[model samples]
Target: MKRILPQPLMSLCLWLGWLLLAQSLAPGDLLLGAVLALALPLWTVRFWTEPARIRRPHLLLPYLAVLLWDITLANLIVARLILGPVRCLRPAFIRVPLDLDSDLAIVVLAHTLSLTPGTVSIHLSPDRRVLLIHALDVEDQADLVARIKQRYEQPLKEIFAC
Candidate 1:
């Protein structure tokens, strides 16, 4: 069952991605898309790992929404700093110790942080718990840490752990 459906779904997404990149939906392209929808995953089996199985499907959209909004806001803030005649950039590297220990939670946290405009996930400790983040504008490291904990890590714990 896993092999059957996951393969097809993967193929379908690959097909859709190709279509999107091409920006056309003509009849010949449709045929090629159908071929890709059946062939790509079969050809790429050894390269693919089993995807991370998200436990809470209900949290999916809300998580996406949170990420989208954060990305937009972060982009605007970063743009303002960059476009200003005098850039008031207070760049700082902060070591944020994380309490959410689950590997999935950590993955989400790292990805979320990197996705935001001005923040980059510089490094994760060997133990995979502590994250070293670089913020483009770090007014107060404490406030940034608090925001990361409250806005992302807390909800990640609830969604993935609790």
Candidate 2:
């Protein structure tokens, strides 16, 4: 079973995605989706170095809820900033220390930060110990660093802890 569907969830998503893209539930599409779902994971499995394993999987829902809420709030704040005076803008780049040992978790954290309103994940240090983030506006750099650590990094550490 494992060999047949190396990533079962990915397979299911591929099937659903194929159907959605095709915009039809015809028998041929179903067959093609099933084949692609089975084949893609098998072909690409070799490229994956390590499989992801969530430490406290139960916290995933709460984490997602918090992320969604933050994203929404960020959108509003960014919109306001954009519409307001340009002179008040205080854009800066800050380095955020990484506690996540897993590459996958670190990548997810970076992506999440990028998805939020005024912040963008600039780069990760070569040692992978720190992530560089650029913020569009900031009154206090320390506060921004602290919030990123507390709100996003800490949760990711817990979620991806080994």
Candidate 3:
């Protein structure tokens, strides 16, 4: 069973995604979707270096809601900053210490920072202890670091339990 269905969730997603993409539920489409769903997972399972597992899966929804809210607010703030005087912008790179240990958790944090409006993840320390992020306008580095840890890292630590 493990060999036949290496990643059942992925297969199911692929199946559903195929149906939605094709916008059809006809017999032939269903058959094709099923075949692709089954085959794709089997063919690509070897490339998955790490198994996708969320330690605190129940926290995912709330975490996502918070992230989305932050993203929206960040967008508005960035727009306001961009419209203001160019000289007022203070771009700086700040190093955020990592608390989450898992590679997946680290990846999520980096992606989250990059997704936000005024910040971009520039580099992660080779030791995986710190992430360097570039911010468009930062008044205080310490405060920004504190906020990132509080708003993003804390939730990710809970969500992935890493």
Candidate 4:
């Protein structure tokens, strides 16, 4: 069963999604959806890496709250910066050194930075030791790097244990 259905949940979701999009219960549609659901997961399973193990699952809620709060605050700050004089904008690209060794943790950090307004993650070093970010207004690059490390990276390191 495992060999035949490597990701049964994914397959089920795909089938349901297909039906939902098609909005049909026809036999042909059902057959097609089933075929797609099974085939897609089978084809993609080889590309899937090992799943990330959360070391501190309880911290997830707190992490999410912090992320949401930061997003809200960043939205207001970015709005102000955008509305203000163009000359006041100090856009800069800074490389944040990573203490995270896990690929999952690094990806999460990159996504978190991108999700927050005014900041965009540009590139990750080949060795995965650093992440390059572009910020809309950078008063102090060191401060921003430290804030990210403290607020986001450190928590992620603790949570993911990487």
In model 4, the runs with Cα more than 4 Å from the true position are 1-43, 85-87
| Clash count of each predicted structure | 0, 0, 0, 0
User: What are the lDDT figures for the candidates, one per model?
Assistant: 0.81, 0.89, 0.90, 0.92
Best by lDDT: 4
Best by TM-score: 2
State the TM-score for model 4. Answer: 0.75
Please give the distance, in angstroms, between residue 153's alpha carbon in candidate 4 and its true position after superposition. Answer: 0.6
Give the lDDT ranking, best first.
4, 3, 2, 1
Model 2 segments beyond 4 Å from truth?
A: 12-37
Candidate 4 residue-wise lDDT, 59-148, digit = tens: 988999999999999999988777866666789999999999888889999999999999999999999999999999899999999999
Q: Estimate each model's TM-score.
A: 0.74, 0.83, 0.79, 0.75
lDDT of the structure predicted as candidate 2: 0.89
Ranking by TM-score: 2, 3, 4, 1
Residues 1-162 of candidate 2 have per-residue lDDT tens digits of 899988886788799999999999999999999999999999999987777567787877887898999999999999888886676789999998887889888988999999999999999999999999999998999999899888888888888883
